[model samples]
Target chain A: MDRATLELKKSRAFLCLECGKCTAICPISRFNNSYSPRRLLADGLFYGADNLITNPLLWSCLTCQLCSQRCPVDVKFSEYMRDIRAEACRQNQWGNASHGGALHHIMEMAAAPALKQNRTGWISDNLKVKSKGEVLYFVGCLPYHHDFFAKDFDYAPLTAAVDTVKILNHLGIEPVVLDNERCCGHDLYWLGQLEKFDELGRLNLKEIEQTGAKLVVTSCPECALALKRLYAERLGGVNFTVKHISELVAENIDKFEFSEVPLKVTFQDPCRLGRYLGVYDQPRQAIMAIPGIEMQEMPHSRRGAICCGTTNWMNCDAVSKQIQHSRLTEAKATGAQTLVTACPKCQIHFRCSQCGDESQKVDINITDFVNIVASALEG
Target chain B: MAGKVSKTKKKTAKAKFVPNIVAFACNWCSYAGADTAGINRVQYSPNFRVIRTMCSGRVTPGHVLKALKLGADGVLVSGCHFGDCHYIFGNYKAVEQFDRTKALVKTLGLDERRIRLEWVSAAEGTRWGEVIDEFVAQITTLGPSPLNHKPKSRK
Candidate 1:
């Protein structure tokens, strides 16, 4: 059998019962009737891999793993989609990349072996950090996002990194911050550029190993997922343990002394942190630790959480806008003053969805969960 | 003995590198500026290649970075002066894009001088020639781009 067929067998796509559970729950399938995970599996099974590979709908899968979570027979639909995308990438078939693929090119540039990145300029004098230590804070692509989004968006992306370090310092842990760190390659891996992703992974792993860090903490859930899971699964394995900032904060919630902010906030569970890494509760726990804070849970929370409209910055269209609009409306409906997210991309996408379109605008303040924790820290 | 001397001289000459610059010139201004320079017979460095774009804003960061990644020693984005843009505010957009592109380029460890944004009008033919000559010279001094190398064979 061909490799694509083998992937289908390995991911248990053949065991699909045509239950349409995946389709019914899919955020994309709700707005886009043409996209269905079950139908894609059936097409691969009956019509063969070629039909499945060439189909444009193949790129439409968000790979958010919502389907796999709902699948009874344990069919890893998102993993199946990832494998197929790798095949498609090998054939030079790229999806309609948003932002004219500028973000992808940035990742590729970061993958260059000889690159001497000056990525750590955001480290302010106030935050305590070390050049090498046992705990390394992986500040991934936040600086780039800060530069790229500075013009239009009022949101400061780098504040998440700064706030993370502040929270770490408050916990009496001065984490190592590397100056020459490459991207974590989460986007590249999802986009099926496995070769570049591997290159980036190897480079990042070498840098982290040099720091002698036993624990890797990241504010961005995508970076955390890549370092913790994708690196272990794809690039042999890493020496250090990876933790999302939420996990670290949650583990030491008792150590923190927070000021009374008295704000009602709702959490957006990033798919990578929630489903991919099973880190649903830690972020909520950390948020609740803030004094005088009221935590309102969205209707679709934890495993059932809807994705933040898009993934890997691909296939962003009207459906993505609608999903974002609906998600924002849901956050606003809970009577929360702020919609706090654990992921920077979530904050960016939600803010981006509110731009330009007056009719689709949902009035809500979006922020990173770390920013809240930092703000609530008692000096 | 004479051949050895000649070989040493050849090595020294090879050290005098000619930079490969990929210039994105806007059609309304910079591209026509180049034409105006040619009409005026102004002399400039011939090492740069010009790719005419509809507007300087058309040259996204992806384009500039792709050129460098594919072995461009330097990239020059030339557009209309502020308030002189044919598209009203296309040059303003170009400035914004250029700022972001420069930041990314710096983050990637390339010399920020290797990538530049300049305002040149069609009437400023001599200025166009001067920009090219100066940018090419600057890139040469900075040496070849670190990203300049053969594409690695994928595993």
Candidate 2:
């Protein structure tokens, strides 16, 4: 271990008290025994990095921050794990098929001509505006990774995104979509591949800057969070504000009116959007602005909301499924007719889990919160 | 015979050295308790040196080690009892952390007994004095630290 890393561990060890609260409450631990925040601190303190760096448990964390909240001493155990993982990557101690392996797979897919042909190829027919617009909508890796645009609801995901451009145009806001938008490097950073993260962040930042847009709007919460927090602070000099589409639509609710559709809707707070970035009210306000859509809340909504378990940061499908099942059970218990979430990951996770239910199944709507408000428009 | 007796008495006087103690008192509970002790004019040994922190959670292991390394014979960590932390549940974390540090000190062959953790509420002025008096007497009997003896090479 480096001197600085040792000193940090020493300092952190003083804060941690081996209170097994983190390990007990973690949602991922239902599947993987190796992922324990308490164990990580103890190992770091007593045994040092010889055990921590190579352990597969480090990357398995959902970064849901449940541990940090439960900690009595304010040890900041979750951030410590992140720092440890980051250090492991810094020292080139990563194993094969790391957390970012899926991201690498997706990046490879992006390079394929067949994959690139359909990905992000769809745009509004009426978008005759030039490539340079005041706002840029970064669709992120989801529309490409999940083939979301091609699958489901009459190609509505991509079309709605295009329609979003039209909606923005109607609001006197012409937004540009990057023809070659790459993954926002959140996956790489979360995976502890700092080198890849740096390379990808620089590449994405360069491409985004070329559009000359003053503001960037994203439908993906992860992409929005990464761009707004990580990219803004780390890769400075990119003078732009990153807003989620729901935030943007909520800002312009005066321009849209609801038709009183009499739908009971409940919103699931995406981990990145709500807990990580403090975006609770914007989506709710947008949803409530729709006249007849009564918004009910789950017990664990907003800050304390459960993870949807389909984080792009980790490749643990087994753990993700376990988390998904738990969250879906809670969502169904809320007695709401329709379940709406902001993140594409949350939508994908919930949809995958909801497929097996045969009876008393709640209708799962994967539409962006903004799309709902946009649909409510009288135009 | 008288000259020999005088020389031996001088040597005994030189050997009778008292230990220096540092005590950490919380602003809410322990500090007020100490103030109560003073107001009541409860006479105790002036061996203890008290430093005030906002809460018991702020009493880090580093503070303990730093005090010991800087020639404090004993360290007294006093705070509000469990569920009494003004910040709520901070003392639990503090106690847990202190226990682990105590274990580390034991492994290093240092006198972990010299370091004491106590919960003294504002009303527990008598308990505070009793704790300090007992620690001072105990440390005075234990004498100076082994760290002052000689540095050992484990390698």
Candidate 3:
């Protein structure tokens, strides 16, 4: 192993004791026997990356971080997978995009400093947002999703984006909504396109600084994580505060009016929100504050929540759908009318899973938590 | 290509002859108006599925587009009369969102006439009934929504 690879192995992967605990808890491993985190690590440690990188199973990992959670030896298989993915992307060897790289191309284009996107044109006039405020709401690739997934997914994507602003408005805070907001480069960083991710981070930080917002807020956990954690690590330290919408909503949960619709609902914690950022209670606290509403527990709730599956627009195979189908079945079994999720990707993936094959349909409504709060707000 | 063709075939086979209407009724006025219409026993089309939001401004382009994509033959958004919004300017936002949603749908080549936004106040029970009758008549004439035959992505 190279020095960088060896350092990662020593600090993380080398500690693996081959307990198979990660594989046991893995959602993909359960369905697809050919790909196992433990076996992948074993192969890497035994034969090395040169041999293992050629294996197609390398792309199949969801990187949901369940293995690290259950691993007795604290081997972060997801991070390891991310590192491997980055290397493969550098070599131009990666899985196919389900959308023919349209989304990836958009992200790649966003890395440029001169690209002026007409992306924010979709911001409806009803939203009371500005280019400068004390708070900056980093609108990520949501506009792209708005256009791309329009035919397949509901206005759920755009609804989450707009409701996020509306909820901020309800909180008496008019967010600095940047029309020139660039992608957070989360997809790039995770896909191993590190320099492109750094450029985007630099570009967004420059734009956000011009607004002079003291706090940065976003509905997308991926963007929030990238802003709060990765930007500081890979680029430089961000001077401002970055918070997911749920955190801010939980802080102001007492101020909102609650509604009587969908009295009982369950929350699907996104892997980034739940595991990456440790934001579990904020979503629930906001949910439970609504009058006559109850938050149901999915069999896997909080830290144990199942991932919506599919990652970085790569390796979206049958296992992704099976994972989503299992999670939705679990959600429906809870008898909750709606499954309130904090991440738009979760809603999109869950909805996409339900789109194909009517047999996979479960009788539960999938919605963003911000939408729920926005809908339930009385005044 | 095979999957796409099969999907189209399946959609046409189980088509609903009746229009599937999704209505966004504002809470303070239009929703109350709907209640009054029910209380008065005013007959209207049974195809309408009403979702009550606090204000019409709460209805975004996504909601209307989603409704249409989910096979809604028509989406009717009713709220407090202009300048009469319970929240002062919510109806205006609804109007803004309605126009934007309509534009986006038309740009996508879907029929713009499938969506209608109106003002129905709390005391407008008769008006509520008439609106439904009119929207149903309009949708029936427009035939089923292009989205109606498409597969539903929501679970």
Candidate 4:
């Protein structure tokens, strides 16, 4: 390390005693033995950009905060890696090639009015939906982008969401449809593309503002949290309210009834919507309100919930898989007939990993909370 | 008359030797603290140039790098204390970025002494002055960044 660089690490190293607790509990290390948090920190402190930019391990972190949670001194190894990744980006080093380019492509698509305005078209014609209302449903990109490539993934949820809008219509809660709704920009920010995030945020805010819709509901937890949190910086002068569709449905629980489906269900909390954004109770309340359904808790629930490995924002393939496997195993151990999650990303990732393995045999039913609520409504 | 004459001459020399410092104060805390300093007349170095931002977390590593790259002799980043942020932990995020960038800067052979992080609450205007005084003195001792070592190739 250069003298100046060493001088800086002196402080960082002073605070970080190299206890290796970060490496010990790291979920990434469980799958890929090649990943060493101790080495990454040492390289960062000793080698600077040389090791960080060149090492494939630097980009292999899922940033699930598992290490941060376990660290005794709060060293924040994952965030340190994020800085290294940011520097790599600045130097034109394409660390994770798979999803990095796709982020830019998605941003371009999100900005186009033609594409954004037709977002609701992803729903089938058989799903009866009305156009004007005070509530607007923002169905996020996963179901639209991946289609049936995900396992046990049903587009029937899209119909259910439309059915939710119809139920609201029946209740005299006129919901306005922002057919021009693009992404709420969670992916762009998570992908480390702040500029693209700003553009997408502006577009979404503009479209949402045009609707004059007081209540914004979305099927995606990531989008809900992003709209509620991230846009405060991006659109300083604009203000609006956002709610997950489940939260909306939970608020209106008395208006609906369940047919007592015999299936025990465990709910998966999306990271952005849960720990990262602090939306835990609303989703759970919605799940529990369903009559005759036994609610099961995953070993890791709420703020401690692990992210699905397929976060377009992060590029830690090895660690993400490790987390996915752990979460799937835990959810399966609950003996719930189905594993349910609110985010489309979560739905898609779990489906991809299921792959019909007999040992890991468990039925995965990926459905949004609103879909369940809409279906349970006593027509 | 002789004592008055000597004091005026000393003041002029002290003013000429004081380092000129520029600060990018986040709007939430540091900027309000500077305003507090002005209201309280804390008398810090007039050397600082404060640019206000909504949150200190908004300060990207690129901004700090560019400021140093663009010839700011010394940079001071002040934000709400950890957990006290108006946006709740935005400054903590800034803390993470700064920790790495500060480390990165020293690695690139830059003077690590020229950049620092300080937490100044909206009520701590005098603390802001004290921080500026310390930063200005440190930069004065170190001189301009060595990154300015090379002349523009195009020029």
Candidate 5:
């Protein structure tokens, strides 16, 4: 087996009791019949590099931690799959790129040293953003989301970058807005382009350090997760503290006046925000603070909730559609008029799924809770 | 249910206002209800282009958006009343699906009033007639669909 596969085998591969709980809860396996986590772990132990490295089934996992939640032996199937994907990527055997590598190409471009990106056009004339401050608001890939999803659907989560800054300003914070901010290397790292991931990480850190910012806040859970956990895991540690916008807002939620929203809504806990970092209550607490708005719990939420379907922009197919279908249906069944998500990726994925097929669209409004809270803030 | 709705002032200079309404009638209930309405001489407006489906659940949000995107001045998704579907949960599922698309339609510059989702059973032919009249009048007041002038096909 490959090095990553071998490492996984030495760690938890032997611990898997062939219980098949991972496959039972895996979202991908719901539509795809070919995959089973227990079987894959077993194969990782017994199979050689030839059988393990080139197996395209390695890319199907969303790395969403549903399998790990059910694992009797506590084998982290998603993490192991990510490691395996790194090995596969090293051998140039990766999942087929969806959207014609439009997103991947953008992340890859960020990997270039001394990279210059025009990321601030989305900032309107009225918004005042500080160039230097103790707080550096990391606006990750929202510009790309704006341009990419604008033609078909209104991906308002992209505006969370601006709204995040506005919310910061509301709390008497002037966050440092980087002019040439690079794309957060979360997707690339997951895609197993370790060298590129490393380069972007180092570059992003260097940029943030130059801003003299002690705190790095981002609306995207993926960026926050990458900066807080993954970046530290890869490169010893960093000086700055990373906070997902929920944590940032949750601290000062009482300071703002919340107008009555008069709407029932459900929240989709993005895997990065919930399962990975254990930020389940912060978002809910923030939303619940709004007067007259009620929170209805979906049947599957928090750690057990399904993904918005399609991760790393890879292998978006019928299975991904089914997962999206199931998730929207779950939210719809709750009878909430809106579906709120912390992560922009989740918002985009859910909204995109609602597009193309008119019949597939859900009536639920999808947006970052920050925007709603921002709307409710007193003038 | 009114028929002759006053044309809105916003589109005065455009082609004489004729609202195109696409009705997704479920095969079991709404479609048969429309046929029953015709047999009973319900005398509803002639603005509807009805599309029949196997069940109310089969009318996905994509179909509604496609009709609107293709310049259907209005889309009327009529299904079997809740729990009255020929398929056990089709109407319930259809209502849920409609809820899913409601926010989306509002976002796409289509008036929430333009797209009407109703539970019309095969037995309620008069109800179907009334709904058609109400919706046609609603669309007439809303004027031409924003997507009407942009005739290019979209995916």
Candidate 6:
């Protein structure tokens, strides 16, 4: 059988019940009537591979796994979408890339074998990071985002990276930060540029291997998922154990003392962290461990969380804005002063949604969960 | 066999390395400046291609990166002088975007000199020629872009 057929069988999309639960639960489908995961599956099954490969709606799916989570038959629609997107990429049918595809180009460039990056300029003198260690902190694309968004947005994404190291230092573990580390290729993998993704993955795995790190940790959910799960699956398995910083923080919450934050915040569960990696609790545990901080759960929290509206930095349109606006509104309705999220992309997207005209603006601060935890750290 | 070998050697010797440079010129200033250079018959390197945009701000990091990725040896972004922008602050915006683009290019292991930003007013015909000649020479000295390859010819 062909690759599409084989992926279809492997994803179990053939057993779709047409219950419309995936559609009803989808954050995109709620706003975009044209997009439905159930219908996409039906189309895949009935119309064969050719039609499915060219379907523009294929890119519209957030792959947030909201549908697959609610599906009765347990069809992995998101994984199915990923596989089909790989085929679509081979056919040169790409989604409408956002930011004029600059981010994608950055990822492609990161895959270059001779790439020498000054990525460690952000590492302050106080935060002790070694060239190699038992634990490696994967600072994925935060420094790049810092420069890219510096002119327009007030958000400081680099804080998340710095804070992750700071927290690690407080725990008495000086993590390894590689200056020559390439991107984790999470965005490339989701965008179906598998070859470039593999190149980046191999480069990263090789670098991490050279560090002799038995444990890899990252603050970004996408990076964590890529390093912890996707790399192993695609690159024939990584030798080190990968952990999100939240997991590490939660595991050793008692070691450090916290100063009073005294802020009310609601958590935004990044789709990769919560659904893909099942890391819903660790971030919350770390957040709650902070003294004088109150955590309010959004209506759709944990596995049922709504995405930050855009993924892979592609297809960010009115539908994405509406999804972000609604998610922000939900956070605001929870009576929280700030919206805390584990992923840097979530903070970026949320802030982008608020940049609209006054009517569309939601008045709530968006911050990285790591930043919050770092602020509470007692030096 | 001796004749064929000599012919190949002559061909290689005759072919001088010509760099493919992508130039983004503002419609109001740099594009008009290039036209002025042509009308004045100013001598300059002919290795660059100009893509005109309404404003310098329109030449985003994506455009610059795309040019390099698609095998351009270098990229030149020409705009109006800072305070003289047709649109109040479009040139300023271009500066911001160019800075970000340079950071990305540097991180990706490309020499930051491969991309440049300059200001050329509509009347600077001689200056336009000078800019092109200098950039072309610089790129030639730097050699071909690492990403450069013979792109597939389209029918």
Model 1, global lDDT: 0.89
lDDT of 6 by residue, A1-379 (tens): 5677677887898998898998889989889999888888888888775578877788888888888888899999888888899889888898888999998888887876755777788887999999888999999999888878865688888999999999999999999999899999998888778898999998998899899999999999899999988898888888889889999999998897898888999999999999999998899999998888899999899999999999998899999999999999999999999999999999999999989598879999999988898889853
- Deviation of model 4 at B91, angstroms: 54
Per candidate, native contacts kept equal 0.69, 0.00, 0.00, 0.00, 0.00, 0.55
Model 6 per-residue lDDT tens digits across residues B1-155: 97788787777656887999999999999999999999999999999999999999998888998898788999999999988899989999999889999987776778899999999999999999999999999999998787776644332
Reference-based lDDT, each prediction: 0.89, 0.70, 0.80, 0.66, 0.79, 0.89
User: Candidate 4 — which pairs collide?
Assistant: A5-B106, A5-B107, A117-A180, A133-A174, A133-A175, A133-A176, A134-A174
Residue A166 shift from truth in candidate 4, angstroms: 4.9
Residue A313 miss distance in model 5 (angstroms):
0.4
The segments of candidate 3 whose C-alpha lies over 4 angstroms from its true place after superposition are B1-155
Question: Model 6: which docking level applies?
Answer: medium
Ranking by lDDT: 1, 6, 3, 5, 2, 4
Second chain TM-score, each model: 0.87, 0.84, 0.85, 0.81, 0.84, 0.89
- Residue pairs with colliding backbones in model 2 are none
Ranking by DockQ: 1, 6, 3, 5, 4, 2
Candidate 2 vs 3: which has more lDDT: 3
Worst 10 residues of 2 chain B by lDDT: B146-155
| Interface DockQ of candidate 6 | 0.56
How many backbone clashes are present in model 6?
0
Candidate 6 chain B minimal-lDDT segment of 10 residues: B146-155
> Model 5: how far is B50 from its true place, Å?
50
Lowest summed lDDT across 10 adjacent residues in model 4 chain A is found at A143-152
Report the lDDT tens digits of candidate 1 across residue range B33-98. Answer: 999999999988999999999999888888898898788999999999999999999998898888
TM (chain A), candidate 4: 0.81
> What is candidate 3's TM-score for chain B alone?
0.85
In candidate 4 the C-alpha lDDT for residue A48 amounts to 66
Query: Per-residue lDDT of A240-299 in model 1, one digit per residue for the tens?
Result: 899999999999999988889889999999999999999988989989887789999999
